[model samples]
Target: MVAFMRRRTAAALLSITGLLVLALSNPAGEWWTALQQPYQSEDLIKCAYDKCIPEGDDWFMAHLNQTIHPFLTPQSNLSAKDFLWWKKLQRDPNDLAAFKRVVDKVFQLFPEGKGFMDSGSQRCRSCSVVGNSGNLLASHNGALIDFSDCVFRMNGAPTKGYEEHVGKKTTFHIMYPESAVDLTDNRTHLMLVPFKTRDLQWLISAFTTGSIKFTYLPVKAKINANKDLVRILNPQFIKYVYEVWLRNSGGYPSTGFLGLMLAIHICDEVNVFGFGADQNGNWRHYWEELKDKTLRTGLHSGTEEYRLIQKLAAKGKINFFPGH
Candidate 1:
């Protein structure tokens, strides 16, 4: 009887040790930082390397068509009917042939699947959508943000001096033709949120013949990003976010809002930070100093978007850390 008890105690000790090792190896960071807190979406991001999805665009478009159709439209069909929708989005495909040329050129520039496509026992895939809100200034969420499976940063939110608050890791950087900036590393994926066909034309030109430079806003003739790591947003997806999600409340959707929706589609669980306004009710970026008292979320309905974000969080679709 004594020998049996000794063996059972040893087994229990080993089990306890294994649990401790698992917890330390895959730390859940912000979601379960406290002992009593329940596990959240951010808790699922494992530390293993991300698996790249083969022929990613085909996979994404296939999924989008089935579920997020019309809203999540891709280049499944660049026909006249699709061009009409693009025209409605202010793309102005005045000539069908010219529009086809633009679409063909864009198709050539589109990159294959690069990250988080695998769905095996190893896939946990938690994502963090880091906005440029002033609330992140002193939040010191850098460690927490970096712990995510992927971090999506938008609109030139720098991390050099602000590493303590925003974290230095960026798995994906989302931008538009006008908002594009030179990336410091090849590891982060560069996702172009093209607003119009000219934006797609600009991307092809920047990487190929280098003819187009100025758009509605002047842009760089060339950008620094790995060609293989680049991805472009479907214009249909943008329109979908505008009409279906935002319910056509604003002239267009903000890049941050669109970025969040993209994360919702790709990530298993998403954690949002540095979004919305700051404590003083100033609608400004964390990097900015001057305050605009009359600042509004240009062309995007800021009030409704905030409300929607709140609703998503309440519904357990996301964990929103409104630091301010």
Candidate 2:
């Protein structure tokens, strides 16, 4: 009996020691840090080993060149003449052949739905990436923005309501489920940002509501009953965010960056509009009409990334607004 008592005391002491050790340590740190960190799409790609630049086009070009090269058909590899012509056209393909190349590469990647194919199914001409900016107001972009085969919007863009400011035609509503459902009205198209794993549940719930259908995307998947409504992006593409990008972008990739990376991967030529904050660092979307206009705290985390965006835009590698 004394022997048994001694063994019991030792075992109890060991169990308490183990519990104390576990209490002091955090096993979840590895995964928790990964989830909280900033990320980019290209960083998640196969060739995504390099870090991001806070300012410069050289890295942007390297990433774009690598990401787009694999998907570009031999026909669209831009000879000097086509390159010069593209410069003249501002990514607006006037010729049907050029248009088809863009469509085959870009639109083929977007999952098909009944309304997925627009009026000009085989061609994408004069695509206007309408930034959700108050600037479009009286700027007279109505004729310019309505011409694309597909239109994209971000973060509670009000198109039908502010037709002059935000533009009337919204073919794609690209944003996170929380942002899309929170900020947007019924008619605006919904492009989703699948950041968290479960946001897809909300995405399908929104789609089945039948007010406006959505095409939920690549970084995340919809595993629910209404998963049919989603158009998922490949996970190889999503790895670009974690493995290559978050480290470079300092924390997270912008929604615009994600869309741009996707466009670079899928489109022949890409044009970005109304990206980056204005001259002063303020977070405002196209749909917003701000009275203060002073920099406000918000989810659009563009403070550190603007210079990087500017450098790329100036290099003629990308099209970003508020030119230097």
Candidate 3:
């Protein structure tokens, strides 16, 4: 009876181990990351033609509703303390109340109710995070970049002259006061990456009466973007991206890093273009001939960010096109 029991136990263990091995070897196991969309690619450069991140579905929507809804909701009021806590705000001793007022006003500017790309409304939204790397100078990826459901451009990477290399389609232009540009495309959404309370004030004044002109840096007095389409980045969301997504890589998150994080939340599929250094190992913009030796990424760690981006590509979370 003891021998028979031992045989039965050994047989059961073997069967269970085989089943586990089969599941692990399958396409939907540890071999493939859950965050990445399904794709078949033999090369390092992946093409996400129909791939969509599963998290962008109802599961993510429910999670956002339960956690991030308060921060995104327009009716919610954000105080100066909230801003200070989230960001490393160095405000004047006398400007506390004024800062709070600006925060409140900025929150009011946010679109009321749920986001337009909520669970019920969103489909397989493909997004392209177009950076200003010089690698895109002669790539002629305009049509390919434009084919995406939405294309995000950062700073003032213009498409007027470089239409063949970088598409003219700008679904969203993410920028701060210093990098602000006049949006000629009426359809483009002007998304603000507010680094400080003064940045928010600049945005408000730019759209309304053009009152606040000068900030820590010189800013555009007025922008050509539609007032109704302006979207402000939530301070809390910025903190979340910094601490949670980026694991606090640098003192503060770079605008490019923040933009990619934003894309992950809103886009079902993400394809990145015009990011990282060029073939010559110089950090330069596609529109300019000037190249910086240091590859200045400001307060943020640019190299680390680039590696993280590459890691994401390997995991299939994003289809990273190395441009040149």
The lDDT ranking, best first, is 1, 3, 2
RMSD of 3: 14.1
Q: Return the TM-score for each candidate structure.
A: 0.75, 0.49, 0.74
TM-score result, candidate 1:
0.75
Q: Name the runs in model 1 displaced over 4 angstroms.
A: 1-66, 69-75, 78-82, 88-97, 113-122
Q: Residue-wise lDDT of candidate 1 within 241-301, one digit each (tens)?
A: 7767787888878888888888877765578998888998888888878455787788788
lDDT of 3: 0.68
Tens digit per residue, CA lDDT, model 2, 45-64: 11111221112455654554
lDDT of every model, 2 decimals: 0.69, 0.43, 0.68
The alpha-carbon lDDT assigned to residue 274 of candidate 3 equals 89
- Ten contiguous residues minimizing lDDT sum, candidate 2: 45-54
Which tens-of-lDDT digit does each residue in 190-265 have in candidate 3?
Answer: 8887667678778878877898778876789988887767777777777766666567787777777778877877
> What are the runs in model 2 whose C-alpha is more than 4 Å off?
1-61, 65-126, 182-189, 207-229, 233-247, 279-281, 291-301, 321-324
Count of clashes in candidate 2: 22
Candidate 3, residue 230: the lDDT equals: 76
- Could you tell me the lDDT of residue 200 within candidate 1? 74
Top candidate, metric TM-score: 1
